[model samples]
Target: MDPKVLDQAAERAGIIPEYIDAWGQRKVISTETKRQLLNAMAGVADDLALAAALPPVWVVREGESAVLSVALSEPADWVLTEETGRQHAGYLSGGRLALPAGLPAGYHRLALRRELRHWSCQVIIAPPRCYEPAALLAGHKLWGATIQLYTLRSQRNWGVGDFGDLALMIEGTAKNGGAFVGLNPIHALYPALPGWASPYSPSSRRWLNIIYIDVGALDDFQQSSAAQQWWCLPETQGTLSALRDGDLVDYAGVMALKLSGLTLAFRHFITRGPEDPQRRSFEAFVREGGESLRFQSTFDALHRHLTLAGHPTEGWQQWPEPFRQVDSDEVREFRLKHHQDIRFFSYLQWLAARQFDDCFQLSRRLNMPIGLYRDLAVGVSAGGMETWSDRTLYRLEVSVGAPPDRLGPQGQNWSLPPQDPNVLFARAYEPFITMLRANMRHCGALRIDHVMSLLRLWWVPLAGSPQQGAYVRYPVDDLLAVLALESHRQQCMVIGEDLGTVPQEITAKLQAAGIYSYKVLFFERKDPAQYRAPDEYVPQAMATLTTHDLATLRGFWQLEDLRLGNRLHLYADDAIYQRLLADRQKARQALLDALHAWKCVPAKLGKNAERVVMSPILNRGAHRYLALSQSALLGLQPEDWLDMALPVNVPGTTDQYPNWRRKLVREVAEIFDDQGITRLLREVDRLRNKSADGQNSSPRPE
Candidate 1:
C-alpha cells in the first residue's frame, strides 16, 4: 500500500496522525492502525470532497459573519430561509457571499444564484452560551444528590427503582431545599434482552427505558380491573416480594412481571373511547413520535417475537435475512401483522414519558431551582436499535472507546460503534439535535457523558486492541454551537463530563460555551497524598465526592473497592494491585487532612488518618467539605449518606461482578426518615445558602 494514499485517506477521514496522551506523552498512529480504521469507514477518500465541492453546512456563532466557500462567478442574488419559515434576500459582491451578521440564532437555509450557477446549504446560528439559570448567574450556589435509580430501594417498587420512586426522591430532595435530583441515564435498554443491563450502553437515547416505568402509577392501571386482578395474584405478589428483597436488581424477573401487568393495561387502553382524554393524548404522542418512534417500536416487537419464538434474535444483524433491514418488505409486513405488538411497546414509552414528566413537574411545583437533571449516555449499544435504524451513520467494524488512561491502564472498548463524522455533517446534525431534545425534555439540566467526544473520540478497530486505537476528530466548534442552540431552546443547562483524557482546547471551549464542568473529589487531587484547597475548585462546575463509576465514599475509605478489584482479578499483575493499594492509602489520608483543615471534621474525631476508619462522622464531614466548595453546583451521592459499602458500577468488569445492579443499603424512605441524614441535608442546604449570601461555609478551624 502506498504511504501517501493511506496518509491522505486518514487525513480526509478526520483521523489524527498523532495525539498527546493523558500523561503528556506524544504518541503517533501507526500505519496498520490507520489502515484498519480507514478500512472500517466508507468514502474516506472522498470525505473531504466538500472543501472544494458544495458546502455541507455552515455553523455561525450568534452575530458572527463568515464567507461561504462556494463563490459565484460574479455578485449574485442570495435568498435566506430562517428556521421559522421566515425568508430574506440580499445581493452578494465580488463573487463571494458572506452571511449577514444580524441573522437570528436558529437553523436556516441559504441559496445563491449567479446567472446559471446556483447553490444551497444549511445554516446554523448558535447562541454565545448555553442557558445559565438566573440564580446561578446571580452567584447563587446550590447542592443536590445524584443516585443510580436502579439501586434505589422503595417500599412499593417492583424490585428496581421506577419513575414513581423517582418522584418520591424528587419530593424528598425538594422538601429539604435541594436544587435538583440527578439520575443515571434512563435511556431505553433492550426489553427482549433484559439481562443486558448496563445503562451506559442503551438501545436508543431518543426514548425512555420502560423498565423504570411505575406500573401502579399509570392511569391505565387505575381503570383496568383485569390488570389489578393480575397484580393481586399470589404468584405475582411473591415474585414482586422477591425482587424487592434482592440485593441486586433482578432485571429479567422485574421485566417479566411488569410486562405481564403492562400487557393487560394496554388491552384497556386500546378499547378506550376515541374522545377519552388519555386515548386522545396517546394518539397525539404517537403522531408526534414520527418515524424514529416507529423504528424503536418495531425493533422491540420483532426482537421479542424472534427471541421467544426460538429464532436467531441476538439483534437485527442476527435476524433472518428478510427481516434484517428496517425498511424491508418483510419487516413492513410483520409490522402490520403485529401492529398490536408494536403498539404495546409504543404504549410503554407513552406511560414512561408521562410518569417522568410528572416527576419533573413535581420538582417545579416545589420550587426547585433546576428540577430533575438527566444524564445522556455517550453512545448506543452496537446491537441496539439506533445502529439498526441507520447503518450509514456508524462504522460497525470499529468501536468508540478510550485510550489507555489512569482508569483503564489497558484502555477500554465500550463496544459501541462510533458515529461517522461525515454522516453527521451530511445530515446537518439533525440526529444529534433530536437526541439532545429527547434527553433534555422534562429536565432542567443534562449531563453529557464523555462530552469531549464533541472534539474527538478514540476509535478502536475491532481487530485491534484499545491501545492501538487512533483519535478521530469531530466538528467540535459546530457541534458545540448546535448543543448551545438546543440547550437554550429547551431551557436546560448543560453539564460536560470531562473526566478522562480530555484535550486542553476542549476544556477551554466547554467553559466558553457555559457548559458546567464535572469535578469528582477523588480526581480533583493535587496528588495522591494531597488535594486542592476548597477555594481551588472552580465556580462553574458540579463538584461531587464520588460518581457511579467510582466507589462510594465509605467504600473508598474502607478500601473495599481495591479488595473487590483483587477478588475480581481485575489487576493485570500483583504490581498493579500493590500500586492501587498504595494510592488508596494516600487518598484516604489526603481526604482526612483536607476535611480537618477545612474545618469540616472535628479535631478530636480521628485526628490521625492512620488510626482512623470510615464512620458517619467522616462521611458527614466529607459532604460538608464538598458543599463548601466554590462550585456553583454540588452533587451528593445517597450511598454516602447511607454509608453503603459497595459501588453502583465497577468499571472494566463483566460477568465476574454484578455491575449496575446493587441496591442501596436502605430504602429512600428509610434513608430520609433517619434524623441524622435529614439534618445533614438541611445543613448542606444552609451552607449553600450561606455561600449565596457571600459568606464562607466553614465556621472555624476544627
Candidate 2:
C-alpha cells in the first residue's frame, strides 16, 4: 500500500501516526502497525478506497452553522428532525445544503431522499461546558474520608465490606461533620470466579458488584426457613468467622458463602409468587435495566454454567463460536434454556442496587452535602462482560497503557482494550451515555479515573511492548458535552483524576468545564526539600495525602513500600532499588521538615524533627498539613489514621504484592471508636472549617 493511502486510512480510523511522549520526545508509529490496526478496524481490501466511498457523520457545536455534503445520484430533498421532535425541510442543491445555526443542543437526525433511495445520519450539537454545581463553587472547603470498601470490616458483615458497612461508615463520617464518603470503584465483577478481584478491572461499570451486598440484610432472609437453615449452619458460620479474622480478603471463600445464602433467598422469593411486592419490584428492575441488564445477566449465567462444567470461562471468545456473540441464535436459545439461572443473576443485581440505594438515602437523611462519591474506572477488563457484549466498540487487538515514565521505567500495560473512537461516534455515543447515567444514579459525586481518556489514550499493540505505544485522540468536545449533560441531569459533581503525564491544555479544558482536579500532597512538592504551600494549591481540586496506588503516610515515613518492592523484585536492579530508597528517605525528611515549619507537628518534635523516627505525632502532623491545603475538598484515607504500612495497590505487578487484598488493620466497628482517630478527625474538621471561613472573609479584586 502507498504510504499516503495508509496514512489517510489511519487518520480516518482515529489512529495517530506520530505523537509526542510524556518526556517531551517525538515518537512515530510504525507503518506496519498502522496498517494492521486499520485493517482490524475495517475488513476491507483497500481501506483508503472504502473510506472515500463512505459518508461521514456530522458533529457540530450548538449555535454553529453547518453544511451537509451528500452523494446524491439525483436531485433530493432533506428532512431534519431535532431531538425535541421539531422538523425542518430543505432541498439539497447540487449535493450540498446550507444548515442554519439555531438548532438546539442535542442529537438530531437528518434524512436524504432521491427517488426511491434514502440515507440518514446523526448530527450531534453539543453544549460548551460540563455542569458545575453551585455548592462546589461557593468557596467552601469540605472534608471527606476515602475508603477501600472491601477492606471495611464490621461484626455483622459477611467477611467483606457490604452496603451495610457503607451505611455505618456514612453515619460515622457524618457524625464527624464530613460532607462526603469517597469509595473505590464499586463496579460489577464476576461472582462465580472471585479470584479476579481488582475493583478497577471490573466486568461491567454500569452495574453493582454483588459481593458488596449484605445477603443477611435482605428482608426475606429472616422469614425464609431455607435462609435461616443455611445461615445457622455450623460450617457456614465457621467459614464466615475465618474470613473475618484473615489479614487478607478471602474473596473466593466469602463469595461462595454469600452465593449459597443468596440462592436460598432467591428460592424463597420465587416460592412467594409473582404477585408478591418484592417479586414485582424485581420484575420492575429488570424491565428498567433493559437490554444491558439482560445481556450481563446472560453472560454471568453462561460463565457460571461453563465453569461448573469444567470448561474454560476466561472470556466469551473461549466459548463455542455460536454462543460468542450476544445477539447470536445460540445465545438466545441458551438464555431460554437457562432462564432461571439468568433470573438469579438479575435478582442479585436488584439486591445490590437496593442496598446501595439505602446507603445514599441514609447519607442524605444525615444531611451530608456530597453523600456518597463514587469512582469510575478507566476501562473494563479485556475478558469481562462489557467486551463480550459490545465487542465492536472496543479494539481488542491492542491494550490501553501508559508510556515509560518516571514512575514506571519500563512503561505499564494495563491489559485492558481501548475503545474504538469511530465505533463510539457511529453509535451516537450511547454506550458512554449509558455508562455515565448508570454510575451517577445514586451518587452525589463521581471521580473519573484517568480522565485523560476523554481526550486521548495511550494505545499499545498486544504483540508489542508498552514502550512502542502511541497516543490516539478522542472526540474531547463531544465527550465533555455528554459528561456535562449527565452530571447536570444526575445533580453530581465531577472530579477528574488528571495525574501523571497530563498536558497543561487538558487541565485548562477540564477547569473550564467545571470538573475538579485531583491533587496529591506527595506530587505537589517541587523537590524533597520544598513543598507547595497550602495557599498555592488549586481551590477547585480534591486534595489528598495519598492515593491507593501510592504508599500510605506511615508506609512512606517508614520506607515499608520500598522494602517490599525490593523483596518482590519490582526494581530493575540493585542500583535502581538503592536510588529509590535514598529518594524515599529524602522525601520523608522533607515532609517532616515541612510539617514542623507549618507548626503542624507537636512541640516535642522541635526544630530537628527530620531526625526523629516515625511516631503518632508525625502521622497526625502529616494529615493536618494536608488538611490545611487551599483545595476545596480534602480526602483522608483510614489507613493513614491507623498508621498502616501496606499499600492497597502496586502498579506493574499483579500477584507479587497481594494487590487490593489487604484488609484494614482496624475493623469498621473499632475505627471511629478509637479516641485518637476521633480527635484527629475533629482537628481536621476544625481546620477545614476555619480555612473556608477565612477564604470567605478575604476580599477579592473585582
Candidate 3:
C-alpha cells in the first residue's frame, strides 16, 4: 500500500501514527501496526451514517447558538424540538442553520426540511462545567474512606460485604464526622461463572452485582418459612462459618449460600399478587429497566441454564448456533420457556438496588455531604452482555490496553474490547450517555476509572502483543461536554482517575470542567523522599494515602508487597527483584525523612528507617500527613488503620496468587469502635475542618 494512502487511512480511523513513550523517547507507529489496527476498525471507521447530510448529532453549550452544517443546496426549513416537546422553527440559507439560542441543556431532536426531503439530528446542549457541590465551593474540606466492598467484614455479613454492612459503615463513619464512603466498581459480574471475580472485568456495567445482596434483609426472608428453614440448616451454617473465618473471600461458596437463600425469597416474592405494594414496586422497576434490564436478566438466566445442562459453551459466543446473539429466535424461544427464571434474576436486581439506595439514603440522613461515590470501569469484557446486546458498538477483534512503558516493558493488554468511535458519534453517543446515567444514579459522586479514555485509548489488535498497539483518538471535547451535562443534571461530582502515563492534554480540560483529579501519595513525588508537599497538592483533587492498585501504607513500609510480588513471580528475575529491593530501601528512608520534616513522627517508634516497624505512630502519621494536604478531599483506607501488610490485588499474576480475595482484618463495627482507629479518623476530620477554616486548601495544577 502507498504510504500516503496508509497515513490517510490512519487519520480517518483516528489513529495516531506516532507518539512518545513514558521514557520520553519518540516512537513512530509501524506500517504493520497501522494495517492491523485499520483492519480491526474497518467495520465502523467508514460508516455511512457518519457521512450523512447532517451530522447525526450536534453539541451546543448552554447560553449559545451553534451553527449546524448541512448538505442541502438551497434554503431549508427546520424545526427544533426541545426535550419537553415544545418546538422552535428556523430557516437555513447560508448552508448552515444557527440553532435557537438559550436551548435548555438536554437531549433534543431537530429536523430539517428542504423541498420534499427531510433530515433529522440529535442535539445535546451541555453546561459549561460539571457540578460542584455548594459546600465544596463554600470551602468545606472533607474526608472519606474508599474500600473494596467484598473485603468488608461484619457480624451480620455472610462472609462477603453486603448492603447491610455498607449502611453500618456509613452511619458509623458519619457519626465520627466523616463525609463519605467510596467503593470499588460494584458493577454486575457473572453469577454463574463465580470465579471470574475481578470487578474491573464485569458482565454488565448497568446492573448490580447480586453477590452483594443482603438476602436476609429482604421481606421474603422474613415471610417465607422455606427461607427461614434453609437459613437454619447445619450445612448452611457450617459453610457460612468457614467463609466468615477465612482470610480470603470464597466467591463460589458465598454465591452458593446466597443463591440458595435468595431462591427461597424469590419463590415467596412470586407468590404475592401483582397489585401488592411490594409487587407493584418490583413491576415498576422492571418497567423502568426496559430492554436493558430484560437483556441482563435474560443473559443471567440462559448462562445459568446452559451451565446446569452441561452445555459445552459457557460464553454466549460459543453457545450452539441459535443462542449466540441476544435477539436470536432461539433466545426468544428460550426466554418464553424460561420466563420465570428470567423473572427470578430480575427480582434479585430489584432487591439489590433497593438495599443500595437505602445505604445512600443513610448517608444523606447522617448529613454526609458526598454520601456514596461509585467507580466506573474503563471498558467491558469481550463476552459481556454490553457487547452481545449490540455488536456494532464494540470491535471485539481489538483490545484496549496500554503502550509499552517503563513499569511494563511489554505493555499491558486489559482484555476489554474498545468501542468504535465512529459508532459512538453516529449513534449520537447513546451508548456512552446511557452508561453514565446508570452509574450516576444513587450516588453523590462518581469516579471514572482510567478516565484518560475520554481523550484516547491504546488499541491492541487481538493477534498482536500490547507493544504492537497504536493510539486511537476519541472526541474529548464532545465527551467532556456530555459528561458535564450529565453531572449537572444528576447533581453528582465527577472524579477522573487520571493516574499512570497520562497525556498532557487532559489535565487542563479536567480542571476546567470541575472534575476532581485523583492523587496518590506514592505517585505524587519529586523523588523517593521528596514527596509532593501537602500545601502543594491540588485542591480540585482527592488526595489519598493509597489505592487498590498500589500497596497499602503498612505494606509499603514493611516491604511486604515486594516480598509478596517475588513469591508470586510478578517480577521477571532475581536481578529485577534486587533492583526493587534497592528501590524500596531508599523509599523507606525517604518516607522517614519526610515524616521527620512533617514533625508528626511518633516518638515511640519513628527513630530510624532501618530499625522502625509499621508502628501505630508511623501508620497514623502517614494519614496525618495526607490529611494536611491542600487537596479538598483526603481519602484513607481501613487496611492502614489496622496496619495490615498484604495487598488486595497483584496486577500481573493471575492464578499464581489470589488477587481480589483478601478480607479485612476487622469487621466494620470493630473498625469504628476501636479507640486508635477512631482517633485517627477524628484527627482527619479535624484537619479537614481546619483546612476549611482558611487553611491551605486551594485549587492548583498537579
Per-residue error at 321 for model 1, in Å?
1.9
Better of 2 and 3 by TM-score: 3
Writing each residue's lDDT as its tens digit, candidate 2 over 577-600 gives: 999878876777677767766778
Put down candidate 3 lDDT per residue, 1-702, tens digits, no spaces: 798988888888899988899999999999999988888877466664357567888988887758877877788889999989999998888887888777889999999888888889999999989998788998888999888999999877888998999998898789889888999999999888888889999989999999999988889988999999988989888999998888999998999889999999999998999789999999999999999999999999888888889873436787677888887899999999999999999998999999999999889898999999999999988877787898888888899999988789999999999898888988999988999999999999999999999999999999999998989999998999999999998889999999888899889999998899999988877887677777779999999988887898988988889999888887889999999989888778777767667665645565578998888878877887788787888778888888988888888878987888999999999998899889889988887787778553323223
Give lDDT tens digits, candidate 1, residues 231-301.
88999999999999999999999999999989988998899999999989888999999899999999999
Q: What C-alpha lDDT do the candidate models reach, one value each?
A: 0.88, 0.84, 0.87
CA lDDT, candidate 1, residue 35: 90
The Cα RMSD in angstroms, rounded to one decimal, for candidate 2 relative to the true structure is 3.1
RMSD of each: 1.7, 3.1, 2.3
User: TM-scores across all candidates?
Assistant: 0.97, 0.93, 0.97
Query: What RMSD value applies to candidate 1?
Result: 1.7
List residue ranges in candidate 2 displaced over 4 A. Answer: 43-80, 88-106, 112-117, 123-125, 695-702
User: What 10-residue stretch in candidate 2 is worst by lDDT?
Assistant: 45-54
Ranked by lDDT from best down, the candidates are: 1, 3, 2
Off by over 4 Å in 3: 48-50, 312-314, 602-607, 695-702
